[model samples]
Target: MVFGTHRALDSLTLEVPPGITGLVGANGAGKTTFMSIVLGLRTPTNGSVSVLGLDPLRQGAELRANVGYGPERNVFPDDMPASDFVKHLAEVRGMPRSEARSRASDALWLVGLGEERFRALGTMSTGQRQRVKLAQAIAADPSLVLLDEPTDGLDPVQRDEMLALIRQISSEYQIDVMLSSHLLEEVERICDNVVALDAGQLVAQGPLRELVGDVEGVTVELTEIDDVPGSVESVVARLTAAGLRVTREPDANRMDVLGASADLIADAVRDAVADSSARVRRIEQRRRRLEDLFEVGAS
Candidate 1:
């Protein structure tokens, strides 16, 4: 996908499986472009998009009926009541008026807006408005939902609530979700799978565990032995003799033992600590995160 000279998406070939999948990347990483293509909102300059086994370009109307969308920005009319707004969207998606109203009410209640369903959207708080956007998206009972920054403009508490609601929609409601968010931490929490993008290209896409993998080393913080000088250095030498590479953190009683795996490094640390009689403060296997993917991509 290209816009004039800027390539929004290039050589992007990815398959998003069922379950909650996270779309993660920095700003302008083609996350929005990819979602737009899946919704048939923008015609790609090249390649085809098939969402849920249907061509988004040719089967857009049918696809839209099966797919729900919670946009990043507020697009609803402020004067409209929350319930009416959600019901109107369901009706536009071809639902009967009676069913739309019922579905809309149910969705509002699910999102914790049952009491405010009839309140004008303009009078609602930012968090409430965000819930309204979510309510309308799922009111028609879409098989899949595309949420673009669903937690945008939300406080920490509101963000947590919104994330929980997202999890409920996927698990309890049995709807597949493709969530786009810059918050890698939130994605790591709820998503079963992940599709990472970098400058419109595929950085990585797979199960979250597979992509995060394991940390390269183990971090060990040691308590200083009051009577022994260079206690930390002795421990380092013992570890080095064990055929493990170690990087000592300067001005701190800590070091990272580098090895092939965390288990091996951990085993080596245990032996070294016993041999040196070092007072240990903390020891744990460091773990990689989604942010590491972008760092690797940038390098």
Candidate 2:
């Protein structure tokens, strides 16, 4: 997708499969632009777009019927009550009036807004408003749901609650979710697969585990033994001699081991500690982080 000379979304061919998939990128990374294209709200300047086996451009109505969208920004009417707002959207999605009303109430309850269902949207807090957006999106039970930064303005507790609700949407109803977020941690916590974009270009795409394989590093914390002089240095020497690269931090009483798989590192650490008569306080294998995807893309 392009606007004037700037390519909002560059030439990209990607497929989003079932389950909860995260759409991740930094600000202005074309996350919203991609969502717009998928929803048929913006036509791609060059290539075609499809959602749920239907062309978003040609079969827009049908595609929308099977899709739900929760925009990043709040675009609700101030005077509209929460229940009315959600019900109206379900009706727009072709649900019967009675069904839409029932679904809307149920959705509000699911989002923890049942008590406030009669309250006007203008009177709700930011967190409450965010739930309202979620309620409206899933009220019609669409096959696919597109959420743009669902936790944007939420506090830490509210963020966790919202994430749990998102996970529930997929696990309970078997709905597919493509949630866009600048928060990589949020994506890492709930998404099974991820698609990352950088300046509108596809940077990374794969299952979360495949993308962030086990990091080749292990951390070992040594128990202090005042009687054992140079215990830390002795352990380091033993580990290095055992063919493992070790970096020691005497003050912190920790060593970072590299140059081998985590399992090998652990074995080497155990052997080294036993030989040096050093007690171990803790040991853990490090895991690759999701943020590494963007770092690689930037490079």
Candidate 3:
């Protein structure tokens, strides 16, 4: 996507599979431009765009009918109650008036605003208003929902609640979601898959687990934690001599195994400890993280 010769999205290509996928990047990373293209609000300069197997540019009306959108900014009318606000959007999405009213009420309830459905938008808190935006998007039973920065300005507690709701929407409700955010930890915590963009270009895109990959590290602890005085340092020195790198964790009794298999690393630790007849307590594989994605993409 380009605007007046400024490229907004360049050579960006990826498929969004079913389930909750996160679109993540820094500010000015062209996330909004990509969403607009998917919504048929803008055309790409050099590439085709498709959503749910339909050309978004040609089948925009049909595409939008089946795809819900919750924008990052708040745009609700101050005087309108939540129920009326959502019902109107549902009707505009081609739902029957009666069904729209009922669906709107259900959506509000789903977003945890059952008691506040009749309250004016002006009286609601920012968190409450955020839920309303989400409620309206899913009111028409869209096949997929595009959520742009859904947790923006939310307090920590509200953010957790909202993330749980998003997880529920995808898992229980079976509605596919694309949550766009810049926060890596939040995406790591919630999304099953992710699409990362940087400077108008694709950085990385894949299932979160695949990107994080299998455990490439481990943590080994000694049974002598209560007596780890000399044994721990001896094990570390031996592992260093045996070509296995280890780092002492903040907790003095444990050390992280780096650049080696869990079994081999554990063996090295045990052998080192055996020199002084020390016993092993436990060894755990460390899970992968989002930082791995950046490393792989940079490489």
The best candidate in terms of TM-score: 1
**Which stretch of 10 consecutive residues in model 1 shows the poorest summed lDDT?**
224-233
Clashing pairs in 1: none
Shift in Å, residue 21, candidate 3: 0.5
lDDT of each: 0.90, 0.90, 0.87
Report the C-alpha lDDT of model 2 over 86-156, residue by residue, as the tens digit: 99999999899999999999999999999999999999999999999999999998999999999989999
TM-scores for candidates 1 onward, in order: 0.88, 0.84, 0.82
Error of 3 at 275 (Å): 11
**20, model 1: CA deviation in Å?**
0.4
Q: Candidate 1, residues 10-115: lDDT per residue as tens digits?
A: 9998888889999999899999999999999999998888998899999999999999999998766889999999999999988999999999999999999999
Q: Count the backbone clashes (under 3 Å) in each candidate.
A: 0, 0, 0
- CA-RMSD of model 3: 4.5
